[model samples]
Target: MTYSLPRQLSSLLLATSILLWSCESFAPRPPPQRKVIVTGAAGRTGKLVFSSLLKQANFYPMGLVKSEKSAKKIIKDNAECGLENVWICDVTKLDSDNEGSLPNGIRGSDAMIICTSAVPKLRKRHLAKALLKAPINMLAGKKPLDFKTLQFYFAPGQHPEKVDYEGQIAQIDLAKKLGVSHVVLVSSMGGTNPDDFLNTLGKDKDGNGDGDILVWKRKAERYLVESGLQYTIIHPGHLKDTPGGLSELWLDVDDNIMMSPSHHMMSRCDVARLCVASLKVSGGQSSSFDCINIDVPEGTKSRPTEIALIEFLDAETTYDYSTDRKLDYSMNI
Candidate 1:
């Protein structure tokens, strides 16, 4: 009688366990997250992309910076991405001399977002000009964003040849070497016209003006296009530090947006969001287009989504910005 009671109890327990298990949905495990590398993640646009990646469940991004100083500031600004995620990587060093090599910490990355660029600082002479114009602008009921009239120059050793061309080509080769499936490159507008005002900013050792940053940028973009990897190349004009999604984002053919004053400039935040969105859009149409933000100073309720981006890409099937030879208005010297 005692053995019979024990056997009945064991059968009851097994039946209960089986019933509980059967109630489960039996959902399979989710797919693993993708690893993305953001070069120049310490910079304004790069940090936004890096932080945005942290929020997404599908991606794990690592920030590749140029120095410890950059790493610290980015980590401080980004509460979502900590120091652990940032890696010291100077793109200038990853040239032909090193065979397009990269630091080991960034290996096994599935994608790369190239936000690095040769930064231009406003000249002191323009600073005084802006200060003089600010009061007059305010009196005329206009925003004192005198940046259009301002002139800028790059720091030493931070030219287009060094950073835009050689450095970017190196990164692309490295990405290919590391088996990265996708690459998103952020290039600027005015590439078709080498005589644009920005070209005047480039100076030689003896102060001879002969550098055309857009030319170097075009070289890099051409290299990326020929790289044969799935890519999304964005050419944003006159980047502003405004909030994203609040403005109407517009995409158009090169230098065409410049014809419209409202659409000639865009928020950097929106561009960064697009960078993250590009990653989400697997099998996306690989093309180069110009983007800008327009209207809605009071803010818009419509946020940027992958669907809208995909639709735009699908509609503009076979779009290519690499072969445009039309030069727009020349920058007044």
Candidate 2:
């Protein structure tokens, strides 16, 4: 015999089922997590980047450091932030022959952000002495200094050519090998023009006509551009340690622009935000630009605008600024 409920009771049961199904359908689901590797995770900018990544719900950050000390420090600094993963690997020590031997921690990453830069410490006198002892390959050129052996003879700790240029190249090579989806480079302004004010900060220790630091950075940028990997290169103006997200941001793609007069500056926190934004907005696309903090009206606190990377990239030829006028914002690739 078929069992049947009362007509009114059956209608009430159906309404309850429909209400439960509707609630389930409207419930929010968690975002998918993506692994990101941050090089130079112990440095100022790197720390900021790591911290910001930690706050995001979908990004899982793994910091790549050069020593146990740095790893320990990062863990301690972010203990309250619940940061867990920290890998020790020196980018400068990587070589093509041993490319396959990269640390397991850096593997399986979906993206990478290179924030390493050499801290200038070598004096002019010491660099001159090292140059004297450097091996010369007359077949190469007038400046026959061998780049392979120059780092060993020069400042032992960190040099721009070794750290900024060679180290970045090694990271790029590793990213390619690992099949990372995108590589975001945290570069500085004034990389294209050697005569910019930042290039004038330190003396030319290598006796080369080009500015030592900026020239190497530009070389690394070019290598990344040619590597065919999806990349976003952000050239932040003079970095400040102020609070972030309070001021509007201006972006341009003209490389000749300079961050002068001390007022043109960006907070490291904002730079970190942009680095993370690049991964979210510019995935599978490549572009390079400069960023600075735009002044806000007094007593009016404004937040930075959220811009899609494609829109910014598409505006390449849409700039209507006068060529003769010198604006505070510009960027270039």
| TM-scores of all candidate predictions against the true structure | 0.80, 0.71
Off by over 4 Å in 1: 1-5, 8-26, 95-101, 125-151, 204-207, 261-263, 282-284, 296-303, 317-333
Write down the RMSD of all candidates, one decimal each.
Answer: 5.2, 10.8
RMSD of 2: 10.8
Candidate 1, residues 202-286, lDDT tens digits: the string is 5633437536778778778888888899888888888889888877677765667667756478788888988988887747468
Error of 2 at 252 (Å): 0.9
User: Which lDDT values do the candidates have, in the order given?
Assistant: 0.77, 0.74
User: After aligning candidate 2 to the native by TM-score, how far in Å is the CA of 291 from where it should be?
Assistant: 1.3
Off by over 4 Å in 2: 1-29, 80-84, 96-100, 122-157, 200-211, 259-262, 298-305, 308-311, 317-333
By TM-score, the best candidate is 1
Q: Clashes in model 1: which pairs?
A: none
